[model samples]
Target: MLRQNLQQKLLQKLSPQQIQFIKLLQVPTVALDTRIKEELEENPALEDPSLMTADEPVSEYDDLNERDDYDSEAKEDTSTDEFNVEDYLQDDNTNDYSTSYNNGDDDEEKKETPIAIESTFFESLQEQLDLVPLSDTDFIVGKQIIGSLDDDGYLRRPITSMIDDLAFSQNVIVEEEDVHEMLKVIQSFDPPGIAASDLQECLTLQLKRKDVNNPIIKKAISIVEHHLDEFTRKHYDKLEKSVGLNSEELKEVVAEILRLNPKPGDSNQVTTKQLQIIPDFHISNNDGILILTLNSKNAPELRVSRSYMDMFDHYDKAAQKDKKLKEAVQFVKQKLDSAKWFIDAIKQRQQTLLKTMNAIMHYQYEYFLTADERKMRPMILKDIADKIGMDISTVSRVANSKYVQTEFGTFLLKSFFSEAIQTENGEEVSNKEVKKILEDCIGNEDKRRPLADEKLTEILKERGYNIARRTVAKYREQMNIPVARLRKEL
Candidate 1:
């Protein structure tokens, strides 16, 4: 014998529409257009309203509740394993698939902007290599060496490893001397230090390209080749004693070395092809009031296809209904439902973005108005979430990738949120203010005797910040500032 127990429990789950809305809400303005285009391609029933003619009649089943009777009847009749084609033959114009929103008369037509293409870094190098006269084997070996260069233009792989690669991959047997000669030729290519193995080689290669008769260039080469360690540690006195140079001559030698590129490949790097930032919101200070406007490019006008609705209407009134026709009508209905859900989700995403950003704008109103980062108040994701009556995760999704343009500058929304720190007077201030103070202190200190974390802590305490030495070090590292020892200069 077996016994069963009865229990009741509650569960929560996201509906398909809710999940879709969440994904759309997280997409920033720059990517929303591409997402919409993908949706358009995937669903034929979905269309851009601007592409439809002005005479296209509006859809009849625009309201979602209009299909309740047909849906209920379909659900009731579809329970059996067999289907009767005659069941859907009756004329039902009101049950046709349609969209909820109509195209506005004032909506302007959208046009796509074309992007220009540019050659990549490797392509430019290959072009230069073509001009070099060499045997086929030498050329292949040279190509392999160029291919082995990292984005920083350094050949990190060992010569022995490359020799094996050439023999195994290219079926070419060559000695270390051949590879070295080809490397020397490549290093002579444009952009002074194209195939250097390390920073020292890179600097030396560039100095050799300059006039060798110049005494300063020769001295700089000697310093880089010999006293590089001492020069890096700013052991200038040791370098002067070793190189037999006076103080003024040592300065000139150091200056020449500093002018050479440590990472030569960075100069030819194609950074101009980077994607431009598209700000999600624009905030303007009109006299004393701050106005927020979402970028219109994000919110596209989408609607159900009028021809699909008309076809569904025509099929509903057909006297001789077939299995194929019923299947076609069902497909149309499904597509129409998807289009309506997508349009609704886009609208909800717009509302949520505005709500979250409005709360942030007001929360940091003082900083935005004054264009002074120190004026920013202490705020966290929860504070805005509570203000706008949404979950912290929802607020975080909006802030993570979104940007806002103000009179001061365009800034990432997440950058405005900082933890609170109490001052000596028991007043709460943004940790950003403390970081700014620390940065100022380090910038003004005599680099010959840079301030340590303990000294920084004392300075903050004198200014009523009451911060600790460890906290000061943490903030300094967060700002990418090195320790006192690394910051010292001669």
Candidate 2:
């Protein structure tokens, strides 16, 4: 026999409305319209004011707590395992869900925006295949090879695997030789490096497409084919010794190799990965006084559907006579409650966004005024959260998805927040400033003898940054800059 014990603990859980607010707060201005439209479609009780007509009477309800007396008693009984329709019919149980915040600005004349369409990477390859004259089987194999080419123009899948795939999927019992033949034809496409297995082959293919008789082209192809390891490791001395070239001659060879398209397919592939940034906040320097404004595109005027309210009234009247109509009342109440919470969430989203951003702007006021990385002070999520009296997670949610447009440029809000790096004089600065200096130092250094991490660290120490060599290396790697050897040229 075992004795049972009772456990008591304070547990916190996010309510449905709080969860809704958190999600809405994280949405950027660009996608917020789509999100609102989705809600409008899902819940008939919610609607944009611009869609409402003058003849339809607006929905109005007093405090849900004061109106719904049955709810208070229903909430007290926790013993029931049975389903309760009154649970949905309960008072929204929230006072902050503002019943009226529609500003009516969405009613202005809307204009159509044009969208651009273009052929994708695969479509372009298919169009090019049209020019080739091949039998049905060879064409099918060629199409398979084209489909196998990755966005970087490399055929990563092995011929054996593709042979199996073609046999299984297309019922084409072709050997490895057929696949290789089709692959060779594909490699001869518009992009010289297309269907290349790896970087060496890709570079060599591009080099062979150039003037083969040219001495520089011959050396470049030889280097890529024979000493790719040495080339990538920047073992220039070994290459110079092996290739029998002096400093100037070796430099020309390396330059020729550098001109080849490493990622040939990406050169023509249409992609929206780099979307046109739509900033959620705009910071304007008006006479050196920075002003921050939230994008109005995110703040749409929303209201409960008037006809839905009339429908609810009809249900309320019918429910008095018929018991079945109570379920309909519960449905109406749930939709209306959801619509109200959503509107309130949008309101909270705007307020929280402005509040958090205001705190950040003031925290880094000097940097905003000058648009100078040097002026930026080290800041983190906790810093802004503490200043705004909000949770760190909340600040993180805003920073993760929001973009701010400044006079200098539009930047992701997360980019502004960096860990503090203490300098020699007991002062702290943003690591971005250190990164900028590292960028500048690398930019001006002679490529023939690029500065190493140790040398860069010494330079930072000389500038009173007191950064360690390893830290400098970390920062260098973070900026996508390679080591001194990789950065070096002939």
Candidate 3:
């Protein structure tokens, strides 16, 4: 059983450097600066080229000088020679040698303190809580409850459970009613419906806060609470007959109901608006041609520090005379090498991102220009990989967490790629396009007698899209559109 086994097997494996390169390729230009700063702080080998000097000898620093081909302003310091890559390699096997580029250079020694802002949800909530006039116990309880509330601001756990947890964990005996009272106070906080027990309660709470005088709204709440089945099933005819309301009246009620805020907690989380998707690359339309420009603001100009490089050069040159100087040089070299890898990683990331996005833009040129779902053609990871001559996994990595802003809207890079479906006219269209058409058809349909999947399929065929009934049904469900019978209203 323990005998040496040899078998021919095909496998695809990536080294640490290769994996790092792929990751760096996807990072957009705007984020690249922060990423660089982080690297400078972590790696001693990395230096800021802005701080280079005439005294530093960079001739012997061959490895770093080669990277200078990208941004040549910064010179390498060739002073102390003792510090080298081998020392750091031997000192810590666990440390990623490439990740140590923390500080930039000796000249730019002092780092300006960053202005801290409210970044956490709880921090924002606590700040808002300070503005309120609740009792100390209530505030303490509220803070705990607020902390427990997720990004959506839903109090997921039961009050009794939380009360028990508090009593047991904090050794503070608190009644369930006290927790419940505090929760109600929190629910009244800026988010309007933060501490509701369930979806129905959440919606109802927000609706009740409104001073609108509409019996339809009152009935809508009743319907959502008790006759939710009737509302969801769209058994409007029966419900109308029972509730004594006609079709037009029901539509008016539905419209008002639609206007109510579903996620009140989201209203206060305004920081998301600040997160701008600074496109890593810009593609403009020229005279019947597409022009591409890499957004340079996002891409930083960086170089190794001259002082660091000079120290190493001097140490190396004077190693015969001074042993201490040689060790200092060795240390600086180790830090600088790390710094170089980080800078290299940053450069590599930009190239990969550009290459992948360019390929995608070309692949779905119509969709990028128009921003219409119908214009989107069927594309896959394999298709892009083939186009870019890169591995499918590499393409996938580029697609993941990457976004592109277009004239139409900002969308995740991966959303443009979908499987193709054949139309009755023997032409191919994206499944996404088909879904869009299906949604449009549903939105404009007669609620009195909603079209079934079979009917929808027939309609598509009439429009030159040859799709099966099951496919139509699948698309409907995927779009969150109900069944024909369920979709029918009064």
TM values, all candidates? 0.83, 0.85, 0.69
- lDDT (C-alpha, whole model) for all candidates: 0.81, 0.81, 0.68
Q: Specify the poorest-scoring 10-residue window by lDDT in model 2.
A: 95-104
Error of 2 at 206 (Å): 1.3
Model 3 regions lying over 4 Å from their true place: 1-16, 28-30, 49-195, 200-225, 267-276, 319-330, 366-375, 424-426, 477-490
Show how many residue pairs clash in every candidate, following the order shown.
Answer: 0, 0, 51
Candidate ranking under TM-score, highest first, comes to: 2, 1, 3
Model 1, global lDDT: 0.81
The TM-score leader among the candidates is: 2
Residue 102, candidate 2: alpha-carbon lDDT: 28
- Per-residue lDDT of model 3, residues 127-160, tens digit only: 7888888776677778779878866767788777
CA RMSD (A), model 1: 6.1
How displaced is residue 179 in candidate 2, in Å?
A: 3.8
Q: Give the winner by TM-score: 1 or 2.
A: 2
